[model samples]
Target chain A: MLTPLLLHVSILGLAAASALGLFATRRESPSMLGSARILAIVATLLVLALQLRRGMEFGGLPLVSRFDTLLMVAVLIVGAALSIDLTRGLSVLMIGALPVALAPLLFAAAIGMPDEHPERNLMHPAVGVHVFLTLGAYAVFGVAFVASILYLIEHRQLKARTGPSLLGMMPSLETSYRLTLRALAAGLVLLTAGIVLGYLYGRQVLSGASWRLDAKVWLTTVSWIFYVIVFGMSFVPAFKGRRTALASVACFVIVMATSWVASFWSHFHRYP
Target chain B: MELSVVGVNHRGAPVEVREQLSFEEARLPEALAELRRATGAAEAVILSTCNRVELYTVRAEGAAGAMESSHWLALQRGVPDSAIASVLYRHAGLDVIRHLFRVAGGLDAMVLGETQIIAQVKEAYRVAKDSGHADRVFNVLFQRALRVAKQIHTTTAIGAGGASVPAVAARLAGKVFQNLAQKRVMIVGAGETGEFTLAAFHERGTLDPLVVNRTVEHAERLIARFGGRAVGLDRLAGTLPEADVVITCLGSSEFCVTPDMVETAVRARRGEPIVFIDIAVPRNVHPGVNRIENIYLFDIDDLQGIVAQNISEREHELARCEPLIDSEARRALQELGEADVHEVVGRLRDAQHAMADEELRKTWPKLGALSPDQRQEIEYLLKRVTNKILHGPTTAIKEAARDGSTPVNFLEIVTKLFRIK
Candidate 1:
């Protein structure tokens, strides 16, 4: 009962904050967007705390249940975006990205909670850590995707000579371009650690589940390869700005698809 | 207390007349002393600026004529009284207060809503307070006027728009770029208007502008103030691609920045936008150059139109501010009235009550045997006695608050004699 109520409240608050942020994009007033950013952060923190408490009650992590995992992913997305906003003062960017974070929570709120989440069985601790790391990596990429969009918008305004509407609100194109690279590297490292941990746990716990036979294995590997390509290209001077922004947008989309389709089909991810 | 102003301003006098009447800072003390000696005014403040010279004074007699200030100005500056009298303007009481508010609010300035006059007023008031030329009357008046100036800008849109061409140009630049601190400017001419616009931009960020002129020496001299490099007109083409903003002002009849020049710069820039402001008389940049991709060009007339629209906006905002100023001024006058009632006399009354309360507290334990009702009756008696004793003086003070001419300082003498803490 408490989980459903908290989930609903978090969804509503996140939705309001995102809407206010959209309105504030045109306004130069910091107070207007500041209010929205604070509300979203508070909502995100409250939901994360509730989810952690639920994890402790269940004797393990919240990633055991599908609804629980989705809600926690929403919290992680908002939490990472809030941290970036605090450091860079990018309330506008937070506003742009928060709606994407809110989607999972809204979906969870509508479905409510199951009496017993079979995914909540803490059969293996290593798999729990792998799930947490992967979710965190996905959250980081969501924020990076927003920063990429900002870079593209600024680039477009400068290209079209449209007298600086979006340009005035966003950070410089160089700043956004650099942020995309930093976020991509950070996301790649976490995803790699999660995959390595997943493989180790699979060998110890699974009965004859090989990378060739499991859908989740090859999909995760493909996503990892794409990240490596992007991470390597960032070092090349010519492939720096527009190419990086495009790669960030494209890579995140592929990663999202891989997570959903691979996890749905993987027998190894289900509890025994 | 009486309020009055004797001044010569831009509206009433020519530049030559104002120059003759102006007093330097070194000569102000002697000028003030002579004016006081001649007018026999109780308190005075002299405000001097490039556009106006004014003397504000308070006299107890309430019969000070404008001729007294006029004669004093003529005698001290060694000018004929008849010559100074021709362009003199005078105000008294409420009119003087209104004039000061208007002056501080920039309604009476040569440039509508200019900020410099308020600073000048503050400086004048500071000098008067430091030199012992102003007392309580002038202090309250000038301070309230300053507050009114602040309130006018904040609560209304009177200061929401730029009233000058330079200010409009700077605002336009702010709209063009997100972070102006990182942007570089290239100035193609050394005209005064361009310099004014550059000065306005200085308030936003420190800009080391690249200045180009027909004469290399002239550009060097102008760019020295900003710690920037000076380039010759021949180098303008090469420098165009590097500059994020370009302002051109040439005295020649021919266009200096043609389509070919802009096309070359744009090709080098690839797609980065550049702002061009041509403030010259015959127009330094060709009008057709605005058709170029990634180039924004504005002529003098475009800036003037922005200025006109800005002025219209400020005028609409002024309508909103006038009522606020009127109500605020009225409230200030009422508060000043109440302050007259409180200041020294209220402090003495407080001290008297504190002394009485102490005496009663020392004897409070002795009244323990008395019933609560009996003790309350005694306390009531004490309060009535204190009120009766102060009734005459407090009534007189309240009267003085309403009528400024009433002798409010008699309570000052009472406070001093009693050695009230």
Candidate 2:
């Protein structure tokens, strides 16, 4: 009851925060949005607390059910946004971040939590690391995507000499670039960790399963390669603006598409 | 006290003449003491810079006090009265207040929006203030002037962005590429304008520029002054693709960078964005090259356009600050009208203005679809109505404040309505 109730409250809190973020953006008051951001973070923590309580009751990780895994990932995304934004004083990012944080929770609430499998050790600790790492990467990329959209807006307004548009509510182009680098680094580290953990789990834990032939494995590998190229582009001056923005969005799309494929079709990710 | 000013600025005098009229920093106290004794003014301040020397005073004797001080100024500098009179200008009454406000706001600056004058004036005021040359009236006046200056800057774009041509170009370059240290800049000339532009980029940490000039020796000379590889003009096509930014500043009449050359570079870059800044007078790059995708081309005229736009945008920002200045100035004058007015009306007026600003912002977007003229008209109407409603009550408050006898209920009513903190 507490878990579902907290999730519902978080969904409402995040939605309100998003709305307040819109208002604060136009007003150019970072402080107003800062409060709403704090509220959203508090709501996120409540959802996290609920997950822990559920984990205690069920005698396993908070990520037992599919809904719980989705929600857990959503928490990380919110956590990433909160930490980066609070540190940089980019409270305006909450305009994009709150909605992104809300999406997974809303979806999870809609679908209901998946039943836990009896022999749950197949959902191994290595698998948990992979899942958490992948989600951390996804959340970081999500922020970069929002930053790109803001970058385009700022670039346009500056080119045209319009004084203060919605982009004024966002950070400067230089700031967006800094945030993009942070996201890129986080994505690279987490994705690399996920790949390392996936390999070890496949070799030692699930030997002779023919997991190498799996569509999910190939798709994830392809996505990983794509991110690596995107990572290289961040260093190259030629790959800024819409190109980098598009690359980040495209890589994230692959992440989601393959996540769906693995959940339904592949034996590696899903459990009863 | 009646306020008056006597000064010679860049407009009224040549720099040589202004320098002659100027006061040395060490002798400021002696000059202030001498001026006060000569003019019989209650208080005085002397602001002396390369561009201007202004003597400000408040006295019981009014206009004669200003002349007496000006005469003293002339005698001290060993200049005859006629020589001083050649450049001297005087302001009395409200004009003195307006002049000081304009000086603090940077409107009186030789370069519009230059901020150094405010600091200079503040320094002058501080000296006058600490040494007992300036007392209550001068203190309130200068303090209010500084407040008005800060208010103007906070509310306007006038002092917001870089105002110079090279600074604008550097800012533009900064916008295109975030890490100036990483990106390669190519400066394709070895002249004054080229050196300045290159230095601006260098200042931004775009350290290694590939210099390409018609004469490789000149390019090498520039490379010695500013760190960069000297690429020969003959091999420009090969080197062009390596640079994220290409600045063409040849003094020659003909086009230095052609459409074909940019096309070759673009193809090499796989349509990567390249910023082309043509600072040359006769145009170094063909205007047709702007047709290329991912190419940003800015000439001197284009940069000047940005400068003009920024100035105009800053002016728009100034438009917002003007009314606030007027209100705050009037409030200052009101307190001057009666010393008790500050103790009574200060907090209440601040609260009311805050409420006005908050409400205006909340309602601004609702009127967004209307034309600017229509919106401005509506704003005027709103301001007129609010001012009209407040005028009588404010007058009564000031009247009540003449001897610290403001009705307690009047304060309570306003505080309750506005929820004044």
| Candidate with best DockQ | 1
Per-residue lDDT over B142-208 for candidate 1, one digit per residue giving the tens place of the 0 to 100 score: 9988988887765555665466777766655654455677787888888888888777766677468
Candidate number with greatest lDDT = 1
Model 2 chain B poorest 10 in a row by lDDT: B403-412
Error of 1 at B88 (Å): 7.0
| Model 1 DockQ (Cα-based) | 0.09
| Clashing pairs counted in every model | 2, 0
Q: Please state the interface RMSD for every predicted structure, separated by commas.
A: 6.6, 5.2
lDDT for each residue of candidate 2 in B1-421, tens digit (9 for 90 to 100): 5678999999889988888889988889888988988888889999998888999998852235244777888898888989879789998755677778878887777766778888998999998988889998788888989888876775555675456667677767666565677778898887787788888888878758899987788887778877778877888888889998888887778887888999889878876667788888899889877766556677888777766766776666666766766666666655665663454466666666666667887998876688889878877776776677767867776766554454424445554565655
Q: List model 2 lDDT by residue over A1-272, tens digit each.
A: 66678888888888888888887776555566776887788888888887888777667666656787778867887887787777877676657778877888888899876554435664466676776787777788778767766666665655554432322445656667667767877787887888788878778867686887777777777777888888778667557555676677677777777776677776665544
What is the C-alpha local distance difference test score of candidate 2? 0.75
lDDT of 1 by residue, A1-272 (tens): 67667777778889889988887776544666888898898789778877877777767777776677778788888888888788987776788779879887876776667677455335367767898898888888887888889877766654443432533357766567667777888888899999888888767766664644677777778888988898787666446566777888898888887777677788665422
Q: What TM-score would chain B receive for each of the candidates shown? A: 0.78, 0.64
TM-score of 1: 0.71
